[model samples]
Target: MDEKRLCLAHDDSLRMLRLARRCDDLVLAPAPARVLRDADGSIDPAALVAALPNELFAPTAQNPVDLRFDDDASRSGCSLVRSCPGLLRLPDDAYLEVLTAEGDPLCVCGSTVAHVLVEAGPLAMTSAAVTLGRAVGAGRLSRDAALVRLTGFAMELCGRYARDPLAPLVGDVVHDIEPVSSVRELRAFLDEPTGLHGVELARMAASYANDGSGSTMETCWYGVFCLPPRLGGAHLTRPLQNVALDWPAEAAGLVSHERMRPDFHWPRYETACEHQGGDHTSEQALEEDSRRARDYELCHIHYLPLTKKDARDVNAVTALLAQLLSIIAPYETDAFARRARRMLNDEGVCAARRVLLAQLLPPRLRWCDGDA
Candidate 1:
């Protein structure tokens, strides 16, 4: 990263830190340099902790956000848990504890606010968290707890915002409860046209977007919720159109594109499915499946299949990388300030500097092992 760009990222992290503190939304963790062992009996632990920021090392609540629940949740089959495999891994005790926490219903798994809405019969008080708990705890505890937890959050969000037409839309899709035997099945479910159930749900989402009656959740719904599944799948034509009509020119620009106007070539989910050798899936296989899914998701956004050399492709890759880095970059703090200065003063910090700078570098078009 260029000096200017690095400084900019540094500044952004500092700003984010301040915002996090003010909003009480973030915790800082800092990684200090470690000592090195030389052939000569000289040991410098400090040498190991390079430019790792203090903000990142400090204990914080954000670490759990990095976890991706790709485990099989069949601990015991339950209606909600059976539908989403990602939730299967949570221990029974932990699963129940999270659901029962008292707060405005939110996905504690990550800081993301729920976007999907659902019907929670006649509740005078509607909170996203409460509604989510209700969904997860609806039946016997036997099921994929995580799916019930996450999808419940989605469904709850939909319910709380029932006044907003988009609520029904989110409710229909998220609460449909498909019994996904594997990640492949889940991927297929997401990629396929919304079944009659999904279509009806989408139609509701569109109706809400179209009528423009309850635009309160527009930002959350479009900017964050729809992003993961937006690029492909489902008949989004009408919803996109409705969004285009309702959103300001700036927000509309984010979701709308020329290709969006036309019918898109839908992929067959079978192609994306990984073939695990045996009936009993191993941890290694699950790990492999997770790797494939990550690649597939990133490829959907970053792949330059047809235009390897195109400037647009280059720009997209770079922008995506920069945005990702911004999301993960450690915020500035007393320790970071000291380290930043030291990195400038000492050549040793150059390695740390490079890692941070890579965020600003134009993302390469070729495949990378990970976002790092």
Candidate 2:
């Protein structure tokens, strides 16, 4: 057939037919080469008859010849004269051997796992963590296996060269998955001989990670507070989270519970830091805060309640850190004193702090030359 006639025939076939598969020079069965109903749901016999090839109309009983279209026009060129209904219904990751107009085998809507990971970016860690948690919660995955999987993803993502590595974020994800592993388990993972990227950062993050954190925001607060001051951080000792406290009998009705557990605490100084965000605005929350404050006063422990705004303000955080440091200084151990002395003179810490500062701060707010 002439090229024009072939093109016209293919176009007409595609309009009504769903191409199942095309073998070498043959269009196989199940291609559905007929439309029995019109848009108004009326049977169109003439339309169906017209859609079928001449071979189908003149068919004998036995040996049937498969319908064949011009290979040059349908398979070897950029022609939209073929439709694959199966391909349309499958997912983007599904693999199918489809031929281009040039008759070259091409993948239809398939992509690698690495490509999907790259496309997801930093949220991939959060997503994987959340998914594993849900799976465990639903009893689909065991808690131990889920922790391994979560840590595996953390290893993969954090090892790569990324600004917001998975190390720091994995803790919150693991926390959400409940019955989280001990810090020892995380350390064991870190010690394993795996080809994980960014090992140093991963180790550092694991050192500071704790399942005791109540929320992602609490994790963020912990991270920022541990870094040196030059990096928009407080350089404070890592505080224990959600430490249980005994409340006086008089506070039983005023607070929600007879016992109190502060959000973050320094046991050495008996100082506690409470992070008050929108959840503390209720009347019950106000009463609880008041009762907690009175309880701390009775116990002779310092209480500092901070808001999100306090955490965001660099100067405010610095001042709060100073207060914490002063209170804890008297109780600082010889070992801690030695570490503090070393920190003051450590060039490596200074360099690392500069890199961390760049990562954490916005470009405009970052330290410039001689700005301190």
Candidate 3:
């Protein structure tokens, strides 16, 4: 990392420390440098510490002599080292930053001259994956959900925001985090016996995790299609993401010269679905889309185009899904509906389903009456 970036990150860290000081019980944990930098860049300091307890650490001296402050209290960094009885032993370099009641910095812990660096700055997908892996290992979050969140966050940074330089780095990091063949092994490693949240982690790992999603909308769409019927989704088979289509040699001129990777594909039904964004409005993009559709038609594949409006409009998306499900398996729609009804009896899961549905469906068209 450059000195300028490091100084900015340090300033952000100090800002976080000031906010954390306002809550008497909260203590800043030793986080990866990327986490600190991203936290500094993306979220407010107060919001970052919102969930932490006010008095997480209490002042304690490792040696009694060090606790005595002569004329300069600033010299005694030990004044801020609180020894909480149940807290785990922190790293040797870990030191608390003490601040006044009004959020002014008092002094840094004298035990260490500076904060420890865990990873490089200039956040990348690998940094996110590492942070997520640690969070799962520590039982702070569910593995599947954390992966989805990480992928979505990285996509926003690298794609929608035009951070083009980070694109290749993000792809490489994602590959390292979730190789095509070792997804199960990766999940196992993330959920290894931490003895704290092992059961929850294992459960989440067992649940369907669509690591293949390429964007935030795709991730959300995947959840809508693959989540169990009990969770207000169709519980359909997982779709392959970014699959390439082989076009006939004569039709090569029609397809986009760039690439022909479909957003989501169902191999068994020879069907594919694409979620079109605002970029599709251009004449050139529309021409490309029509060519792709023609190619799929020629190959006897069903092509479905889902617009951003459709994604946000629950009635439209679900209606289209129901039609597709009927085409896929006419007899199974009733079974899926029944499962959704059973899910409604459990208030907790039903509430979660409602929250997810609200994101994909408009308020008036949101799922109700145990409808799938």
TM per candidate: 0.16, 0.43, 0.48
lDDT of 3 by residue, 1-372 (tens): 111111111222223333342334333343432222221112122222222223322222432111111123222233322211111222222223333445333322332122222211111233345556788779986554464454343333322121122232222121111221123433443344433222343324234554455554565576667666544466678777776777667666654444567778887878888878549988999898888888787666689887765654445556666656655663356775555445434565544444445433323333353432
Q: Give the Cα lDDT of each candidate.
A: 0.24, 0.41, 0.43
Can you tell me which runs of candidate 3 are displaced by over 4 Å?
A: 1-182, 198-206, 248-258, 330-353, 358-372
Candidate 1 local lDDT, 199-261, one digit each (tens): 222222222222111122221222111212221111112122111112234434344232221
Model 1 per-residue lDDT at 317: 34
* Best candidate according to lDDT: 3
In angstroms, give how far residue 71 of model 1 lies from its true place. 7.1
As for candidate 2, its clashing pairs are: 75-101, 76-101, 76-102, 77-101, 159-197
- For 348-368, candidate 2 gives per-residue lDDT tens digits of 544443444333333333235
* Candidate structures ordered by TM-score, highest first: 3, 2, 1
Candidate 1 lDDT: 0.24
Model 1 worst lDDT run, 10 consecutive residues: 1-10
After superposition on all C-alphas, the RMSD of every candidate to the true structure, in Å, is: 27.0, 19.9, 13.2
State the lDDT at 166 in candidate 1. 24
lDDT-superior candidate, 2 or 3: 3
**lDDT agreement of model 2 with the native:** 0.41
